[model samples]
Target: MNFDFIRRDINAQKAKSQYRQLVCNSAASKGKEIVINGKNYVNFSSNDYLGLNNHLEINKALQEGADKFGVCASSSSLVTGYHYAHQALEDDICQWLNKPKCLLFSSGFSANLALFQALGKSEQSHFYLDKLSHASMIDGAYHSKAIVKRFQHNNIEHLTELLNRSGKYSTGFSNKLVASEGVFSMDGCQAKVVELAQLAKSEQAWLYLDDAHSIGVIGKEGQGSNYFADIDITMATMGKAIGTSGAFLTCSEELYEYLVNFSRHYIYSTAISPAIAWATKKSIELIKKEHWRREKICELSVLFTKLLAENVELVTTESSIHAIIIGDEKKALNVSEQLKKQGIWLTAIRPPTVANNSSRLRVTICASHNDKDIRCLAECINKAIT
Candidate 1:
């Protein structure tokens, strides 16, 4: 394999101001603050929407789990790795989401890949996805044997039209799955879950939602899209507002059994840490019981929107993420840099993570953020953009 193309591509990315790099945090981040390069900044780039990252109860549960179940699962779930902790966690999730069964994976990406690939087993499998669906969903759908169609972002009419057109081709053996993100990661806007559920029912199709961004932020009890509609299959990550690690998919008992027997990702990969699963149960408990966290995020988000300058173009959303569109890749990077200098850690989101020339500042407002944090961030963003 030639390494020259890799170098060329990287150089091209740098030239276009699209090169990516990782920055390590020096310490465990607290509510709304992260230490990077020996300086603390208000962290508007985190997905810890409910601010439960370092909570005492969660930590205690983790410790207890480690002592009880050990840190590692030691092998794949089918290979005697699944523990009591995992079972308990799955049960907790099923109960919380009001689903018949739940399956856990090491990460949201893996969970998505598993679900899509498992469902897309044959040429008769048809998947209709949102154009703005996450990369994992796209990869899984395209890589599988399924015939995949993408409707315009959150365009129900387009989705309905596609489903109608494809209705004639449906057969008893064919599987039709309509997939979307509950809260779009980049745009931070919600999908029409209720409408999608209705369409799926009318079309005799299955609905799959990746609620990675919505699980701990939406709904009265953080049940996400599940609170609004009865989705066929729902996946959410524990890393975000749940403030742990791993991901889960909630589905019917039949689908759960099928995935367990056939899903390559789930069958081959090791299960998530039982310790984390135990901790995640505790996290979800807090997410359910403490409505104040969700309320705080809403309050802070409103304050942020109100404080933003008149000229700043922001994607209005009820979720934790807020995208400020900055068209040029270079301009977005510069704006991010300006905010960094002002002691606000906001990331510049650019293509191909987003569409070409749709570069943005993807600000995540967690419950930990206060009125002061929102105000300061808005003021800094206004200054930087202006």
Candidate 2:
């Protein structure tokens, strides 16, 4: 096949200021600093919301897990790869979320694909997703056989209308799933968890929450969306605040067994490293006991909002993410460069990752960040944008 179209597409992206390139970080430490090209900068683009990355206790647990269960699982969970570490991690998640059972995956993407694809087995399966849902959730929902509809972001009235429409035409589908992110990744705004849960119950639909961004940052014990409502199913990743690797889906025992038997992603792929699973248990333990970390994020976030200039607009969110909207893609990149020059590493979020003309500086405030860091960041951002 001719590859000229690939070059054309690349050129088009560059022309539109939408081209993306990977930057190598020589080192990342304490979830608040990264070394790129031998220059260290305060990291404000990380998803480590609770600032648990490279934590001492979690690191020690990882080493102990390796010593006890070895580093790798060597095979898929359906095979001989299911180990004590994996089972223990699953149990920990189930207990933390107060769910009947939990199943582990290599990442949040795989977990989402597994859940949607498994449940969306027939034409009767309908999925209503939030407009700002993560890419993984969108991909999984579209890839499934289910009829998918997207509602306005955080708009329960819109979702209710869509659900009513789906009910009017529903005849063959076995189930209806309503999927949303507990905390939107790009905007950092939260979904209406309580309202969605109530709507799902009233409509007799299954509520699925992708709590990847909320898990380690919300609730008194970091229970995330589960703290707001009794969601039917929830998925969260360990790579963020949990300071480990892998993802997990918490659900009813029947759903767990069904995924084990029928979810191709789970059945075909090798299990996550046993060592990481063991480390995750320790991470959750720390998350539960360390209320100070959550408080730190809140305190820092408030400081950041207070420090910004009057003209600068920020998306209000209780989560660690804060979006400073800069409509033009090129302008957003320029502002990002200016922040970098001032020793802050904030990324420009552009089209496709967000809506058209909604380019922004996606700022992540971690617990590791001090008041000084927030003040400096805010000053730099205010000066750069203005």
Candidate 3:
């Protein structure tokens, strides 16, 4: 049989305790709670950072958009699929991020791929990425026509050295791009975006930020990296903190025009749902006005940290994500099982998602969670881990 290595690889994964599977959710408010197998769980693995997943205003906007423009784009963007709702959402994102232009995509993964492939015209283009960047980024950069390099995670010195030594290996590379995430997903740590911006400017390189995990969870109005530094290019997803679907990439007028014309991913793919685009705009509006939501998440995050036992090691972050390192895959899974028994839903993040011997419980503290929820979660975690 052809492609028979699939079975062997799967069995090998099972033997290593690295097999993956998905659990069905019976129902969910997707706020502080979710139901599975007819039992409710205090959801800590959710990405609904601002807890706006089921907001009434956004729902209303979605319905209105459906009634007006319908949900589907009905064709590729380059064809007749580009709708008014998509244009409005793009405009809103451009204003929110202070960018000259914006473009929408079905998903952040496709956006990343499109950007890298479009910019990587030839060997004259070089792409430098952070070591801990998302999988989509790695795939995009590697598959592109550009020369690619990875610096140590969050290490400004390493990145600087790589840039300084670029000419030592090759010359005449006109386009140099530096890419990083605003907030890393697994570790919940933030990139040093200010330093990156400065360095990229000095080196005449373009800075690209994937703010998927940071949007609607940072900045005064949740403008993410734009609030801290002026980035050359940026992509943020609506499904996470934005509490909607699809993604948007913001860039200069020149780059936007280039992508629309030259990017295969953007030119061929069907545009995102118009109704979801309308709902995403509403979510962005909510994100700007709802200071209480951000404040609550901060307050609750601090409380959760304080409540944890000293023996428990937590990766501290300014974002909604928190990682509790368990150091072993099976141990991490056991701890997750124990938490589930306590009616707390925590997921075990194992390799190849993370490094070997660094399995963890990736917890997301939402604005919807109260002090009582934090206290109980902390208490249960303390008992289970110990």
Candidate 4:
């Protein structure tokens, strides 16, 4: 029962499996390029889909918020830390998503953890998830102490079968809650949200959509995948789309208030800086005021997919995320290294991040990237593959 020996054994296995995490140093600029281990390269791996990371207006807003609210709230939200900025941002998200209410968390991970832990009852209730849902969701389900079931990714039939089986066992408890990502992070495939929503309705299950990757990049005004589908609760992260830090949940007013009262993650954790909340409010405004960004990103994504298809194996995704499946971990790593050497950088997405045998280079294209940047990326990819 020596835990140190057990930990060492696990670390050894991870090292042997090439599952070690690597660090990359980022440089400041248009935010499209970054420096990794002192090497300068064009970045194709960030989640800043609109290149707002270095936006002047965002910076100005941040300064303004900081000047007005100082650097820290210095307490948890339930302990007098919720500022006007926090309330404002929450309201903004509620309005944007057209929800009756919204609640904020420090990060998307925390938000999911709070939601699943609060809503997913232990044993008496079950949580069903997509196989490809983010680790946050899976970890949250595990933490929820619920009976966890997973259906095959995007396989409505598998989901339906699972739901049908659960229906027979609903005599003693809450049935089940269905959860999924709007966009699969590594593969870039979208959830069959509309279909899943209908299935949830017919099966009498509550639906939770974590639209972290799609919130800022998908839907008409970026209300996220729920706009295209029906969902009882929609979770999003400001860090991804709004170019700020923190997570949000938009749902019915009752559920929102319930979470504020009962969710441990929300009630216990230190609230985000009021300045960040203020900055996020401005970011949302910018995202709504400018509709062209979403359209431009969609166009770039399609263009990147089409061009990459000509030279290498690429997954067809309409979202901002485009992946080149290399299958083997080592080969994916090598391909990523080769691309980086050619001044193009994309992370080698490997097993554990994705399923076994689905390692890939997840290239994220932002609207800030011009056609020439994408063309250059295509050229680099072609050359690297050759």
Candidate 5:
């Protein structure tokens, strides 16, 4: 059969306001600028909150790693690809998070999938998650064989209700796992990690937090929400904060061993380049020593929020990610385009990326951005809004 139905559906999406298109970014220069569609734009859509991606030292470290280990590992970690660099990086992550053990994954997405599929599957197990958790976490729950229940976003009471009810089903399953994003990617708000941890403890459930945005972007010394929340199973990605590739999970030695032996994603995927691990080691050092990066991000976040609040309708955020709440998807897209016309680049985030009726322009601030960058962004957004 011809796939004209698919084509017609796509065209109907454009007519009904759901079609999507990708814009290619040709080049990116540091200090808050990116080139797209042959034009320069002030970038406010990147996740490099600490500005580590363009750090000269990080570049040097990556180069050194490459010189030592080349671009690719010969096999998977379960095979012979596990190198000294990989071991060192894993050690550093465990030390940083104060976890007894850590296991590396090819990506944060895979790590989430593997964790749920491997740990949350049981006739006696149930998976509970925040309604607004990351896509990976949601997908993991879908892939899991356990019963899945999503509580209201950041609603601790609702979560507690779920935990209490889960006990009634103990005849069917003996395990419960709670998953959430430490820092929500769209709204930039943090989960009540401590509260969740305590609830999980009282209910005898396992708590899993994905710290993709928070690690290297929040917490003391960038230890992530786990330090503040005292969580046991925490996943962090190196690509965002460490300015490298891959992801890892920090947990007790028992869980670590279980994942190594049972997590299919970890066992099946090709090992990341060992050089990336070496660069991760250096990144961990910078995350510790470069205390000023954290301070600078906090200051810039406040400045941007303050300036935007004076004009655009926006939410106040403690983290580097901020949102200008524009309700309709088409309206958000038009506003994003208007800002882009002024050489300011911000993505118009739409549902299903976020909840329907909550579409907005997501603004991500980075340490590399200066006051001028924030001021220009504020001015451009003001013009776009008006």
Candidate 6:
């Protein structure tokens, strides 16, 4: 009786076509193809942008790490969980991003939460986020003690106006922070990193970029936003492009110390898997050297675009994600089902993940996919949508 709202919310979600359920893969998925319900499907819904999900070397490193350092951290980093693997991974990330320090977390969501909660420690802190930032970032900002404002997505002018306006309400000196995703997860659009960095510099605000979808997919060396601009903070997940588990935050030494000392999430939580960290380090190394992988994604993306029907509303994106807007929840799901029948596994992104009536099939064109795969997906999507 006391938890009646839970049932009500579930029913409301079902009625609105916003209820979510997970689909389990029957076999090991290595990026390009997946087996589900004893059938194979071209995996367009995967986030392994660079197509290194099951690299032999990375897998070997994971095994090596498990043999050397065990799988789990066993304790909090401050207590005893900070293994050599984590330290080496952190060091590698710091060098790769050219940051003063790096800290590892269990996942990107928790890392975002920890960063916001640590930096927004007082009311004097003001956080401005892009309207289309990842849900984790929105949650982090809203849950923090700081005053939060949201600017129009990728609108530098709107962000500037908000930054200027924040001064009017602050009682005294304020710690201002601007947060955005380097590459928006759903829409596959990139933030104007250079402009944002400049704006943050002029306003004396820290620019925080969530590169969950960018790292290991963007930049010549896969340094992500750091290659384009000197960001104050960057958070990226190893699970997406690096094809491993856990996440890391790169920041200045001072901010790093502040987070390590004050962040409750960091202080109390157990460190990420040592094996995964080691594997992630190897993945980053591969990402940096494998220019062909990034090029493959670009080539396949262009081919996919060329093949899709003119009537299909696929958004142009430089990133791996290709969002085909269907504008209706049921319609999007129907299209997804059609694609599934044609041996393509594209998921329908519904409301709450996206805006109302903007449900889409988020297609991820990875390096693992070939021209044949692209043709199949495009033709299927084109026929289904048209």
lDDT on C-alpha atoms for all candidate structures:
0.93, 0.92, 0.92, 0.84, 0.85, 0.92
TM-score (all chains, Cα) for each model:
0.98, 0.98, 0.98, 0.94, 0.96, 0.98
- Per-residue lDDT of candidate 2, residues 1-386 (tens digit): 58889999999999999999999999757569998899889999998888888989989999999999999999998999999999998888888889999999999999999999898878788899999889999999899898899999899999999999877876654488999999999989999999999999999999999999999799989999999999999999988888788899999989888999999999999999999998899999999999999999999999999999998989999899999999999999999999889888999999989999999999999999999999999999989987
Highest lDDT among the candidates is held by which one? 1
Please list all clashing residue pairs in model 6, or write none if there are none. none
State residue 251's C-alpha deviation in candidate 5, in Å.
1.2
TM-score-better candidate, 3 vs 5: 3
Clash pairs detected, candidate 5: 124-173, 124-174
What tens digits encode model 5's per-residue C-alpha lDDT throughout 35-92? 8878998889988788887677777888898899877888888998888888888898
Residue-by-residue lDDT tens digits, candidate 4, 107-199: 999999999999875677789999989999999999877889999989999999988887776777565789999998887889999998999
lDDT of 3: 0.92
The runs of at least 3 residues in candidate 6 whose Cα sits more than 4 Å from the true structure, single-residue gaps closed, are none
Candidate 2: worst-modelled 10 consecutive residues by lDDT: 166-175
Give the alpha carbon lDDT tens digit for every residue of 146-187 in model 1.
999999999999999998787766655667999999999998
lDDT of 4 at 127: 90
> What are the RMSD figures for all models against the true structure?
1.1, 1.0, 1.0, 2.0, 1.6, 0.9
Runs in model 2 lying further than 4 Å from the true structure: 172-174
